[model samples]
Target: MAALAREELALHKLHTAEHYVSKAGLRETTDQIMEAISGVKAAVDNMTLRVDRIVENQAKLRTTRS
Candidate 1:
């Protein structure tokens, strides 16, 4: 009857709210993971540049000695 309909409506609303909350949590986690990946990429780029400079300097020293 009417009481049963009301209960069903309430349950539907609760499920909808839970779904949104779960989606929001997943979005936040994805954002955090992307930020971490960006930070690691920046660090790797910095290390590569430093290594290249070191190698170039060593080559110059070898040429001067010869």
Candidate 2:
């Protein structure tokens, strides 16, 4: 199975505890955490794509200069 991310792990621990946990239940916490993870993953993906594009552009520029 895939490993849970840090935020997901913390949520799971919070839900499992007997008392003083966040008012949000497991499903709600899970949903919110998933949304956060999704946002972070999307940002990372976008950054990766942009970096790749930049690298390609640099290579093209270098080749043109040679």
Query: Runs in model 2 with CA error above 4 Å?
Result: 1-24
The whole-model C-alpha lDDT of candidate 2 against the native structure comes to 0.88
Question: How much RMSD separates candidate 1 from the native structure?
Answer: 3.3
TM-score versus the correct structure, for each prediction: 0.67, 0.65
Evaluated with lDDT, which candidate comes out highest? 1
Candidate 1, superposed: residue stretches over 4 Å from native: 1-21
Residue-wise C-alpha lDDT for candidate 1, range 1-65, written one tens digit per residue? 99999999999999998776676888999999999999999999999999999999999999999
**For every candidate structure, what is the RMSD over all alpha carbons to the true structure, in angstroms?**
3.3, 15.1
lDDT of 2 by residue, 1-66 (tens): 345687798887887785655657767889999999999999999999999999999999999999
